[model samples]
Target: MKKYLLLSAFATLTLLSCNNEGTSVNNTVESMKTPAMENFDKAFKSLGDPQNRPTEEEKKRNTSELSDRRKALLVPASKELILSLGVTESELMRKTGGDMSQIIVWATQIYMKKSDEIRKNIKSEK
Candidate 1:
């Protein structure tokens, strides 16, 4: 009888532990989502959608707009790096107009690659 009781108790604890783990897994999944991540996902999805594709005529106009958007997002903080490097941000913008081609044409120009810490933070989100 004692052995039977012990076996039953062990089974009960095992079942309880497994139940707790399932709850934790559900919580983990729920916690994984954030507004920024949702926006990022949506942005990529829209980019991939066939309806969003641009024509050759739209390329120049769209390129300028995209460049402005990127500069607006990044140039504010990048000013210090730009100034310290002794490069004129305005002229750079005027010349490249936000195109990545500057890096290829002027191989010596400063290029900012994403840092490892940034990569880690982005990776951790998912």
Candidate 2:
């Protein structure tokens, strides 16, 4: 009886977790329609394609694109703010985790998303 009760409890918990996961996915998909999400989608797509993954050159290129976007969008004024928030140039470089090229690609995506938020706030203010 104890075993049966435990099994039932586990099943219930599993079902609840699955339901929550479904809801989260739905919400995430809905949220992806935003401009920031669109940029994220593009950045990730450009970086994560399997063909891009295998070649060092492609990976480096992707990282360069990300860094460029971060610079272009955020400009110099936001550098301190971004650094204070823990997304500093050094931190981003660290994120590459020794994979020199992949580091660049991922960091760019991170900054791009941040820039999108800043832009959104500016728009809201005006």
Q: Give per-model TM-scores.
A: 0.29, 0.31
What lDDT would each prediction earn against the true structure?
A: 0.49, 0.54
Candidate 2 colliding pairs, count? 2
The runs of at least 3 residues in candidate 2 whose Cα sits more than 4 Å from the true structure, single-residue gaps closed, are: 10-22, 25-33, 54-126
Kindly list the per-residue Cα lDDT of model 2 for residues 41-94, writing each as its tens digit: 464565455534435554567553444444333233333333445576877456
For residues 1-117, what per-residue lDDT tens digits would candidate 1 score against the true structure?
999999999999999999997787556543553433333334434544565555456675755443433333334334334344456868657766755434223321332132333
Q: How does model 2 fare in lDDT? A: 0.54
Error of 1 at 86 (Å): 31
